[model samples]
Target: MPTIIFVQQDGSEQRVHADVGQSVMQVAVNNQVPGILGDCGGSCSCATCHGYVEKDWAAHMPAAESYENDMLTCAMDVTDASRLTCQIIVTPELDGLVVRLPALQT
Candidate 1:
C-alpha cells in the first residue's frame, strides 16, 4: 500500500494508506478524509475530487488525460499543480505522495 498525505486548506493533514491500483480519491473517501468529495465516483465528469499535487511529487505522476484536463477546467482555484484525485491511481512508486485540497470545490 502507498501512503498518501492530503493537506486541507486549513493546514490540517490526513495521511492515508491506499491500496495499490486504487484511485487517490478512493483512498480519501475510504478513509473518510474530510477534504475530498469524489462525487463522480472516480469518473472524469465531475471535478469534485480536485486537489493539488505537491511539487516534488508531481514529476512522478502521469499527465492528466484530455478528459480529466477538461474536467479540471470546471474546478475552483486551478493551478499548474492542480489535478483531479480520481484520475490519480496509486502505485508502489507513488508511495508518500502528497496532495493539497483547495479552499473549496466546485
Candidate 2:
C-alpha cells in the first residue's frame, strides 16, 4: 500500500493508504475524503476529480495524457500542477504522493 496525502484548498491534509493499482481518486472516494467528487467514476469525461500535484512531487509522476489535459481545462482554478485524480494510478513508486483538491468540484 502507498500513502497518498490529500491537501485541501484550505490547507488541511488527509493521508490515506491506497492499494496498489488503484487510482488516487478511488482511494479518496472510498475513504470519503472531502473535496473530491470523482463524478465520472475515473472516466476522463469529467473533471470532478481535479487536483494539483504538490510542487515537489510533480516531476515524479508520469505526464498527463492528452485527454486528461483537455479535461483539466474545465477544472476550477486550474494551475500548472492541475491533474485529474482519476488519471493518477497508485503504485509502489508513487508512495507519499501529495495532491491538492480544488475549492469546488462538480
Candidate 3:
C-alpha cells in the first residue's frame, strides 16, 4: 500500500493508506471524501475528479495523456498541475503523494 495525502480546499488533510492498483479517485470516493465527486467513475472522460498535484510532486507523475489533457481542459481552474484523480494510478512509488482538491468539481 501507498500513502496518499489529500489536501482539501480548506487546508484539511486526509492521509489514507491506499491499495497500489486502485486509482486515486477510487481511494477518495471509497473513503467518502467530499471534494472528489468522481461522477464519471474512473473514466478519463470526466473532469469531476479534477485536482492539482502538489507542485513538487508533479514531476513524479507520468505526462498527461491526450484524453486526460482534453478532459482537464474542461475542468474548473485547470492549471499546469491539474490532473484528473481517476487517471492517476496509485503505486508504492507514489507514497506520500499530495493531491490538492479544487474549489468545486461538477
Candidate 4:
C-alpha cells in the first residue's frame, strides 16, 4: 500500500494508506479525509474531487485524459497542478503522494 497525504485548505493534513489500483478519491473517502467530497463516486463527470498534486509528485501521475481535462474546466481555482482525485489511480510509484485541496470544491 502507498501512503497519500491530503493537505486541506486550512493546511491540515490527513495521511492515509491507499491500496494499489484504488483511486485517490476512493482512499480519501474511505478514510473520511476532509476536503475530498468525491461527489461523483470516482466518475469523471464531476469536478468535486479536485485537488492540486504536489509539484514533485505531479510528474509521477499520468497526464489527464481528454474527458478529465474537460471536466476540470468546470473546477474552481484551477491550476497547472490541478487534477481530479478520481482520475488519479494509486500505484506503487505514487507512494508518499501529496495532494493539496483547493479553498473550495466545485
Candidate 5:
C-alpha cells in the first residue's frame, strides 16, 4: 500500500494508506476525508474530486486526458497543477504523493 498525504482547505493533513491501482479520490473517500466529493464515483465525468498537485509532485503524474481537462473547467481554482483525483491512479512511486484540496469542490 502507498501513503497519500491530503492537505485540506485549512492546512490540515490526513495521511492515508491506499492500495496500488486505487484512485486518489477513492482513498480520500474511503478514509472519510473531506473536500473530495467523488460525485461521479471514479469516473472522469465530474469535477467534484478536484485537487491540486504540489509543484514538486507534478512530475509524478501524467498529463490529464482531454476528457478530464474538460471536466476541470467546472472546478474551482483550477491551476496548472489542478487534477481530478478520481483520475489519479495510485502506484508505488506515489507513496508520498501530496494532493491539496481546494476550499470547495464544484
Candidate 6:
C-alpha cells in the first residue's frame, strides 16, 4: 500500500493508506475524505475529484489524458498542478504522494 497525503485549501491534511492499483479518488472516497467527491466513481466521467499535485510531486505522475483535460474545464481553481484524482493510480513509487484539495469543485 502507498500513503497519500491530502492537503485541504485551509492547510489541514489527512494521510491515507491506499491500496495499490486503486485510484486516488477511490482512496479518498473510501476514507470519507472531504474535497474529493468522486461523484463519477472513478470512471473519469466527472471532475468532482479535482486536486492539485504538489509541484515537487507532479513529475512523479503521468501526464493527464486528453479526456481528463477536457473534463478539467468543468472544475474550479484549475492550474498547472491540477489533476483529476481518478486518473492517478496508486503505486509503490507514489508512496507519500501529496495532493492539495482545491477551494472548490465543479
Model 6 misplaced regions, further than 4 Å: none
TM-score of each: 0.96, 0.95, 0.95, 0.96, 0.97, 0.96
Say what the RMSD of model 5 is: 0.7
Model 3, position 79, has a per-residue lDDT of 90
Query: Judged by lDDT relative to the true structure, which candidate is superior, 5 or 6?
Result: 6
Candidate 3 vs. true structure, TM-score? 0.95
Model 1 stretches with alpha carbons more than 4 Å out: none
Model 4: pairs clashing at backbone N, Cα or C within 3 Å: none
Candidate 2: residue 38 Cα off by (Å): 0.7
lDDT scores of the candidates, listed in order: 0.92, 0.91, 0.90, 0.92, 0.92, 0.93
| Model 3 segments more than 4 A misplaced | none
Residue-by-residue lDDT tens digits, candidate 6, 3-70: 99999989999999999999999999999989899998988888999999989988888999999999
Worst 10 residues of 2 by lDDT: 52-61
Locate the minimum summed-lDDT window of 10 residues in model 3. Answer: 54-63
Tens-digit per-residue lDDT, 1-106, candidate 4: 7999999888889989999999999999999988889898998898999999999998898899999999999999999999999999999999999999999886
Residue pairs in candidate 1 whose N, alpha carbon or C atoms collide under 3 angstroms: none
Q: Which pairs in model 5 have colliding backbones?
A: none
Model 5: weakest 10-residue lDDT segment is 54-63
